[model samples]
Target: MTADMLIFFIFVLSIFLGFELISKVPSMLHTPLMSGTNAIHGIILLGGMLVLASAEGFIQHVAGFIAVVLGSANVFGGFMVTDRMLQMFKRKK
Candidate 1:
């Protein structure tokens, strides 16, 4: 198989493994784990934004722009949800 196809297969396999592992976690751990993942997603969003800013040419620019938008949406939305969840645990003091 070609290198690209091999890489794609590995990516898919990793995603499948990730889901399987996550599924095995205790229910109470899900929120914390998801919060961490959202933080990582925010980092990805920043990277996407950087790429969009530095991209050259129309096609690359367009692709980068799309990536930035999608990533930013994920980052913002994830953080919002995480914040809301965390608030539930806050003390009233």
Candidate 2:
């Protein structure tokens, strides 16, 4: 298989693996997991920006831009979820 096909296959495998791992986590651990994943998303956003900066072709630029946008959304959404989870534990006024 070509390099692009191999990368696509790996991406698909990672999606399945991530889904299985997340599905097995207990609810009690989800908040902590979300925080961790937020950090990961930050890293992904940085990587995407770096890739976009170095991208040459129109397709690569578009793909890199999409990756950066999605990564940024994930990071922000994760933080929002984490904040909401923390709020649930705060004593009511």
Candidate 3:
């Protein structure tokens, strides 16, 4: 009923929904999904920077830093994975 509890419930529900949805996706669609998620991660990275810019307290700053780092790592890792997947289809010279 409280705001924190509502957020927690929504977070838990999203985890379940996301897992169910991803588990059902065809393998052929994953490359496109990875690309899409990378774009979202880039947005997350931008959001983190904005959070860092607006942060007034040490805890907020630390949270923002972690968010930015993780978002950046996710974006780069997604790109690497997508590249490797694409490479699998290339013919050797």
Question: Candidate 2's residue-wise lDDT over 31-61, tens digit each?
Answer: 7787867756566888899999999999999
Better of 1 and 3 by lDDT: 1
Best candidate according to lDDT:
2
Candidate 3 lDDT by residue in tens digits, 23-91: 877787777687756755566778888888899899998998998898788777777777777777677
Task: Check candidate 2 and list the clashing pairs.
Answer: none
Q: Which stretches of candidate 3 lie over 4 Å from their true place?
A: 1-32, 35-39
For model 1, residues 1-93, the per-residue Cα lDDT tens digits are 999999999999989998887777778668867886876667777878888889999998999988988888788887788788867868877
Ten-residue segment with the worst summed lDDT in candidate 1? 36-45
Model 1 scores a C-alpha lDDT of: 0.82
Report lDDT (CA) for all predictions: 0.82, 0.84, 0.80
Model 3, position 74: C-alpha lDDT score: 74
TM-score of each: 0.57, 0.59, 0.58
Clashing pairs in 1: none
True-structure Cα RMSD, model 1: 4.8
Models ranked on TM-score: 2, 3, 1
Point out the higher-scoring one by lDDT: 1 or 2. Answer: 2
